[model samples]
Target: MRRSVLGLLALLASTALQAATSVRYCDYPVYPPVSWSDGKQPRGLAPTVVRELFGRLGYRVEMVVLGNWQRCLLDAAEGRVDVVLAYTSAQREQTLRFSKVPVLREEVAVFANRQHPLAFNRLEDLARYRGGLLFGESYGPAFDQFVAQHQNIEWVSSSGQNFGKLIRGRIDFVIQERRTGQLFVEHLPGAGDIVALPPALSVDYLRVAVSRRSPLSAHMAEIDAQLQQMADAGELERWLQESEVTYRDMVRQP
Candidate 1:
């Protein structure tokens, strides 16, 4: 009876270990309406959807909020974190394995002060004016190349700061994700003075990426299957819309 009990205990332990897949997910501190950390807690749309995704996969997530976008990238690349919520880029693919299905498609746009408004039909049209962008954020390959060649574009830490610069006429325009910029405008003081301009810069799909060095790398196929299921069932879209409404309501509260 003692030997039988010990064997059963070992079996149970093995089953528990197989079921408990601990994921260390990291994201930047501020990218409102998408992903952000309120103090130590992860909040916003991406986190909401991510939590649901992993929950379905029978995995436990421990969020690690970094101080900046660069740090998040570095931590994921160095295997300090298991995964990161990030956009796929050619440069990043070297060290990170991206999800087969994207979580969301982000619409990138240009915003300028209402009083000092500027218009652009093409990428080259914006070359005459100064611009602001978040440090380490990428719009797309073309825009990234454009910003790299231009000296007039300045990088700030957050969208709020860029909007402030735009309102003050310190920068002629700022490029950011439309929904994210709108969220910042709704919350930040004096942000009402800034408006999104015509012509979107780019539309990039965002995905959850696991570090190449992570032990979870072998489970990429299973992760993609789960993501595909959510997409097919339309749960991903519903979660995104629900998260946006929830966040808006939270911000409006007294």
Candidate 2:
């Protein structure tokens, strides 16, 4: 009877070990290709990659589609979520534990009115122009230095709104992701007026971050290692491509 009871207890322990680890993840829902939900469900390249990587690591991932970029950062900062993916910037690194593997790179570029394009290979060239930047977003150390030293630049609330204001000639040029601005403009009424430039401010690497308050701090290195493995195998890009195709199909469906 004692041996039988021990065997049953061991079986229960094994079963418990097999159960998925629950992880809550948050992301900006408006940013497409990176993260955006269909209102009813979460679906995007960033979320897809997060889901796949964690799933393989034995975690049951749940995606939270937070309203705005700033709020999503806040949620992660407050430890209201276990992890936040596709995050970048040294400013953010000061507050959160970050992934060593960069999920992707975003080219920070300037968009201007087609008639008066802002031409420059370097950031210093734009010092003479009045630049419009999103209020809560950080472009990195160099851009931050430029913004601080240049009185010509002004910060605004929304990237979409900034693009609109730029179209109306309210601001000289707006800074944001090259692909993001393109995707956003494609869906906007004033898309015809905006033009993204050839020169990018920087290629910011996107990474998954864990909150300092999260219980998963011990596993961050493990997560980073797994992500690096995925990167080495080109699994991350392959997953992104697959998710892009899926997102396109989902959007195309009537």
lDDT scores of the candidates, listed in order: 0.80, 0.75
Across 1-254, the per-residue lDDT of candidate 2 in tens digits comes to 99999899867644553354787888665556676567677666788778877787778988776556677778888889878874566777766788887888888888889866766778998888887875457777787878888877776656667887888887788887787677767656666978888877788877888887777655676687778888899887887676566656666777
Over the full model, what C-alpha lDDT does candidate 1 score relative to the true structure? 0.80
Q: Please give the range of 10 consecutive residues that has the lowest summed lDDT in model 1.
A: 11-20
Model 1 CA lDDT for position 18: 45
Total backbone collisions for each predicted model? 0, 0
Q: 44, model 2: CA deviation in Å?
A: 1.5
TM-scores of all candidate predictions against the true structure: 0.88, 0.80
Model 1 stretches with alpha carbons more than 4 Å out: 1-20
Candidate 1 lDDT tens digits, 1-254: 99999899867644553465777888775777787555558787777767777776667888887767788888889999988878888888989999989988888888888888676888888999999977778776887888778877988877667888888889999888888888778877777778887688888888989899987776676678888998999987887777677677777777
Candidate 2, residue 42: Cα displacement in angstroms equals 3.3
